[model samples]
Target: MTQQPIISLRDVGVRYKRAGSIFRKTQYYQALKSINLDIYPGETLGILGRNGAGKSTLLKVISGILKPDSGEIINRGASVSLLALQAGFDPNLSGRDNAVLSGMLQGYSRKEIESKLEEIQDFSELGDFFYEPVRTYSSGMRTRLGFSVSTTISPDVLLIDEVLSVGDKEFRKKAEQVIIQKIQSQQTIILVSHSEQQIIRLCERSIIL
Candidate 1:
């Protein structure tokens, strides 16, 4: 029997309103037009495009952050996570607290995420810094924390938007290894990147916007 898609998009379109110069009327633009996609289980899908091609927009739509102006999305109870560094984080909250909030946003219960808190802390290697407020963290420290939570919470569909090259050199290596392991372990992933080589290496299928 043929496999069914875990998520499906039918005739989806997203329109955005943009301001015009002082001499002209405002206009709307289509970021995505009549897009139809099927995201199957255990597949590493790649989305490739230049800047302004709505790559991030597509990921947000998949993650349910953006509602399409037209068409429908069929997400059959599967959870989707977008790899965002600063999303859902509060500057006043400690790293640990933010992790819990982020995981909850991914559809996990508070208890479920708290159980994995130690692992998230360990993977981030933030040590005492994990208890510190996010405002006190350096860029690298913040990146590590966000990356750890997003990866550790473990969603059914992982949506990455050019975040694989994040953090310092050592951490980047560690992050890349973990993503490789995820791909090897049959985790479904949708990655958007400008790097052709990365797409070719990690994705089983790709689409260009």
Candidate 2:
């Protein structure tokens, strides 16, 4: 029998209005137009597009952070998480606290999130910096924590938007290895990347925008 889709996008469209020049009227830009897709379980899918082609927009839509201007998203009880850098973190909170918060937002209780804290801390390799406020973190540090939390939570559907290249070489390698293990374990993933080669290497199927 055929597998059922964990998430489905039906005739979805997202538009934004941009300010125009002094003489020109404001214009509406369609970030995503009439999108129709079925994201099945345990499949690694790649979205390939140029910088302005809405790859990030699609991930945001799928992650429910952005509502489409038109059509419907049907999520059949699947948990989706975007491995977004510096996302869902409170600048005033410590990275350790933020990790707990991020997990709770994804439906875990405090105890559950706390139980995984040590693994998250070890994987991030933040050392003492993990207890520092997020506002003190550099981009690399943020990436490390974000990646660690996202991976540890183990959401049913993972959305990765070009995050593998944000860290130092060693950290990047480690992050890639974690993703590889998830892939091997049949995790459902939606990856958006500018590098076609990377997409081809990681994804079972891909679509070009």
Candidate 3:
């Protein structure tokens, strides 16, 4: 039997209202237009485009972080974990606290986060930094913590933005390993990245949006 399509989008479009200059009273930016896609289980769909190509907007729609102005997104089966580093984070909280908070926001209980806490801490390699307030962390440190906590508990679908580039080489390697394992395990993945080599390595099919 054919694997079910875990994600479906038909004629989807997202328009953002922009404050226009004096010459132009108002306008709308069309982020995604007439996009049609079907993402099945066990697929890694690479999305490629230029800087203003609406990659992030498309991802947000699929991950339920944003709603499209037109058309429909039918998501069936699978818990989604989004790799938007700055998202789901509280700056006032320590890295460790933020990890558990983020997990709870994603429907994982405190007990579940407790069970995976050590692994998240280890993978982040933040050491004493994990105990420090998030505001004290550099962008790389924050990204590492976010990446580890987000991926430690496998979700059925993963959405990754270019935030992976924010970390160090060692962290990048760890992230790649986690991604490889997720793909091999038949978890659906959608990603946006500047590295075509990484995309080619992980994804079997691609869409230019």
Flag regions of model 2 displaced more than 4 Å. 20-26, 134-138
In terms of TM-score, how similar is model 2 to the real structure? 0.88
Global lDDT for candidate 2? 0.90
Highest TM-score model number:
1
- Of candidates 3 and 1, the better by lDDT: 1
- Please give the range of 10 consecutive residues that has the lowest summed lDDT in model 3: 78-87
What is the C-alpha local distance difference test score of each model?
0.90, 0.90, 0.84
In model 2, residue pairs whose N, Cα or C atoms come closer than 3 Å (at least 3 residues apart or on different chains), thus clashing, are none
Residue-level lDDT of model 3, residues 28-137, one tens digit each, is 98999989999888788899888989998998898888999999999886677776554579889999899999877776889999899999889888999989999999
Error of 2 at 194 (Å): 0.7
> Tens digit of lDDT per residue, candidate 2, span 19-117?
788899999999999999999999999999999999999999999999999999999999888875555789899999999998777667999999999
- Clashes per model (N, Cα, C within 3 A): 0, 0, 0
Decoy 1 TM-score against native = 0.90
